[model samples]
Target: MDAQQVFALLCIGFVLAAFDKKKEHFPLPLLLLAAGILCSFVPFFSNIEVTRDLIFDWFLPALLFVAAYQFPYRDLKKDAGLISTLATIGLLLTFILLGISLYILLSPFLEVSLVACLLIAAMLTPTDPVSVVTILKQTGPQEAADIVEGESLLNDGTSIVLFTLMSTMYFESQQFSINSFLIDFLLVTFSGAAIGLIIAFLANKWMHLIKDNEYHIFLSLLLAYISFYIAESLQVSGILATVAAGLFLSRHFHVNGDKEVKERLDGFWGIIELLMICLVFLLIGIAGGQQPYISYLYYILAGFLLMIAARYIVLALIMYLIPFWRHRFHFQDYLILGWGGMKGTISLALLLGLNAGGKNSEVIFTLTFGIVFLSIFIQSLTMYPITRKLKAQEQKKKESS
Candidate 1:
């Protein structure tokens, strides 16, 4: 889109955000999306297309950094084991199962390869940190919120790595081996994280040189993009790098920096987060409205249901069957986390990046767009009620005791 179109969308997003803030009933992301769809009927909005570069290069770093910066380091340390397992092993399991399921169901009717199916799985694997984390912080248990958010912060890297690997194998005909893939994954993931930590440490120390807290915030904003850009240029996961920087900087600032500065930082990031969320959902809505995929409604529903099943199945295996996680959370906690794994702009961004070999491109796009919409629309609305019920049940149990 041109500068004028982009500015217009931001203006609209700001207005929608104001309306959502005042009304305080509907979810802001959903409202923004609906508004985008409505606005798309206008000729001016109909041709707006969100590119992959716009998301990965421009939008994602800020959104991911804000989330990581806000997350409590204490909570992360406490739930590190569960979060790691879910982000890595749980994601792998969901990807494998969902990919296999899609291949079985779709290959019969559509011109899709197994790798393409797996690519689709990779796109949908990363739980969106934006919507789920926001709602859970308000209504869900603190522990549940921590686990979900933490997993999201870590898994975006893994999911992107997976997508890149699968995309290479599909598009470039690159030979894949389990051993080499594992080695590459570890190297890329940890290297990005290490770089981010080092940058964050340096950034924190530099903060001491500046007396103004405002400069500190500006430096952090710079740090987010710098860490991300450097990592990406080095062929590693920029998402993880940005996230690591955010987390480390947050912890350092909270523990040693001025209290007023931390509050100011929080307030600054809060507005940034809101603006990004509004623009992303609004753009997705407007883009989706232009190409209504009603014909693929069945595939969309199937993919959405399969994604949910894959999530619960992984959670069940990890939370209920595994000895380590079994006692940590109640069944309701798992239910909330499982159901709250909503897909958002990231999945769509990945889909936009995919080539999908030509004929299967439409199928992949439809599935990605359709499922993400249903996930954001249905799961976002319902998660709060589910979380509220779980809290109520826990409260009742405590009262009886």
Candidate 2:
């Protein structure tokens, strides 16, 4: 879609949000998606197009930055270990297991490369915890919200790294080496984070010099965009850079900036976030409706099922192996973590970047789209019920004691 069309859709998004004031009918994102789907039937929206650049260049950095920024520093510090483990080791496990299972499942029915399967798995690896975390925050069990948000923020970097590596392997005919992969991963991840840290450090110093605290928002906006641009230009993880910059700047502002300015900055970013989320989800529905994958119905269902199963298996494995995690996060928490992992715009952006997988490229795209659609549609809808159930269980236990 062109800029005008995008802006039009965004206007519709705002209208939809206003209509869903109580959220009694549906979550805001899902409601927007439904609206977009209905709009997709119109002849004007028939050829709705979304490029990787359209999303990554326009939407991703700001959304990532705001999510990271709004996340509480204290919560992040407390759950740092668990979040890191899930983002790294847990992500890798899910990728491997899902990739292998997908290869076996699809091999009999379709001609898809191993790297392509891995790429699909990689696309699904990073969770979008926004919807679920919002529900958890409104309900009880704040720790689950913290861990889910923190893990999602970090895993986007690692998932992008994996996606890039797999794309290279498939497109360039390069072989995977454990040593090289590890080295490259470390370099991209750390370098991106380092760039963010450096930029944030300078920005924090600059923030101090500014007499008008109101202007801090401008600096933050520049920091979010510039850090991501520089990191991507340097062939590092732009997602990580934005996340790091967002986290650092947010902590700095909260700890030292004027209360009024902090609130102003938050209000500013909140608007940006709302607009982005609305447009993105609406676009997701429009994009999904553009393609008729009726023939891939079984494959889509199987792929989504496998993805959820893989996530649960990985989380269960982690809890089983780590006594600390087992004690700290109970069964219900893990269930929430597993189901709450929703895939969204990032996955679609990565899917759009697929250019070299021949016919399998289209197949992978459809599968990723289907899985993401279901993940957001189903997982997001059920999040409140899950949290409510857990809250009741906790209350009942308290009353018994």
**Residue-by-residue lDDT tens digits, candidate 2, 1-401:** 77777788988988888887656226787788778778788777777876788788888888888988888888888888889999999999999999999998998998898888998999988887555444445544678777878898888778887888898887787899889889888988899989988898999889879978567889989999999999999999888899999899778866786678788888999898888888877777787765556778788889999999999999899877888888887778888888778787778888888883455667887888888888878877777778878879988999999
By lDDT, the best candidate is: 1
Q: What's each prediction's TM-score?
A: 0.95, 0.95
Candidate 1 Cα outliers beyond 4 Å, as residue runs: 21-25
C-alpha lDDT (0 to 100) for residue 390 of candidate 1: 75
Candidate 2 segments whose C-alpha is farther than 4 A from its true place: 22-25, 129-140
Question: Which tens-of-lDDT digit does each residue in 1-401 have in candidate 1?
Answer: 78888789889988877766522235787788788888789888766877788888988899999999989888899899889999999999999999999888888887888998898999999998877655557666777888899998999878887888888887777887899779878978999999899888899889989999889889989999999999999988888999999999778866886688889888999988988887888887876775557878888899889999999999898888777688767788888889878888778888888764555677778888888888988887776677777778888999999
